[model samples]
Target: MTQQLLLDILPGALPTLETFVAGVNHAAVDAVRTLTPGHALYLWGGQGSGRSHLLRARAQDPDGHYLDARTPAHWLQSLATDEDRVLTLVAVDDVGELSDAAQAALFALFNRWRAAASTPDAFALLTAGDRAPLTMPLREDLRTRLGWDLVYRIEQLSDDDRAQALHDRALQRGLKLPDDVLHWILTHYDRDMGRLTTLIDTLDQYSLAQHRPVTLPLLKALLTRQHPDPASHHADAGRTSP
Candidate 1:
């Protein structure tokens, strides 16, 4: 089965606990996967570190609700007022980017949730940020609230991890992406997993469309068409500059 074929069987790529490549974030992954109501989980990591992925996975459950920290405060407050709502999980992404009003609202909601911590079906809060909770620029009280639960730092994946991930993903698609090809990709493009995965998917599609196996030459052709050399752009600009 080709990668495109595998993708065609599904609606689109959906991040789930089963699909996550937990390099050093195993603790965070496990907590999000098994967290019960009334508990809270805070995850912090750099871009492409799988913070959003895990948060989304937790939110995939029937009783889970996902929100961005940047979501308007008035809207988040509305969720807090629903005393009869069955909110087993609430995952908030990018907690560090929350606006002032949103921070205030989250602070209030956190206090309310804490008060009901003893309830059997209490709502749980999960959040992610680029930095640890204490280091975030949020309100002091909210920062404290963010750390009131289990906290884990999602570690960034090393180059070796990314290579292994690419290999693993390719194997799953019944494709044997060569070591040289994978190495070429890593050396030439952004090492961020999210972008790399997208590139892999595009390569798969392009290879299928062209009836060609994935190879270094094919990758070079594809990338060249997509991104002209920056040096060329600079030369053109220099020629036209006043």
Candidate 2:
């Protein structure tokens, strides 16, 4: 299957994981490395925090099996067999959304997977929006079992990290962004990397459509169009002037 198809089928793009900067937090990286075979590792963080990105990167292994725990049955079905040699890695995103029955199924799967001495070289990684599985409306058993594994709360990017992330994304898209435009985006929009990446994409489209470079004027125009407040635009325009 094409990379695009794989991405569409998978919860998130795994290739992007290599590009994810874990920053100075060796704890997250160390936890990921210690993921033992037949055990589940829980990675939790707020939205736009790149949890799925890390999980997808781990899924790139040829023997990886990615199941969307949002659909509980698929998660169970993927883990049902004892054929560990077939699948070396399993990643589930939005695992907190699994229903009670699904949680029970997961608990059983984890126990079975953990009990098998010859359980191949397979590892399971789960991502959630909360710090602990207990915070989610999960079964007590699943919550208790999930707590047994290492859990890391991924941190949001710092201001410098966010700026660097924007620069990297713009470079990847083959766009030369001016410092002013970058500053304008960082100042006005949400500081989240995901949103900034999207803003860059939209700016790219706007620039292409107008046959204009991504200058302050074009960016201001786009932002104004999206949120039309003439007074605010005029004030911003004045502030940006030399």
TM-score of each: 0.82, 0.69
Instruction: Please list the residue runs of candidate 1 whose C-alpha ends up more than 4 Å from where it truly belongs after superposition.
Output: 1-12, 220-242
Residue range with the least summed lDDT across 10 consecutive positions in model 2: 233-242
- Considering every candidate listed, which one attains the maximal lDDT? 1
Q: Measured by C-alpha RMSD in angstroms, how accurate is candidate 1?
A: 9.1
Residue by residue across 1-242, what tens digits does model 2's lDDT show? 00011111112222344466666545775666556566667887776576766666666666665455445464565465455446555666666777666666667667665666254544564444446667866767777766677777888777788888788888988899999988877666664444455567777777898899899888777665543333331100000000
Clash count per candidate? 0, 1
Against the reference, the lDDT scores of all candidates come to 0.72, 0.60
Query: Tens digits of per-residue lDDT for model 1 on 1-242?
Result: 01111222122365678877888777878888888878988999887687877777777777677778535667667666666767777777788888887777678778778977898658788888999888998888899988998999999988888899888888777776977899987776764565566567777777888899999888776665543334322100000000
TM-score of 1: 0.82
Clashing pairs in 2: 14-56
lDDT of 2 at 120: 53
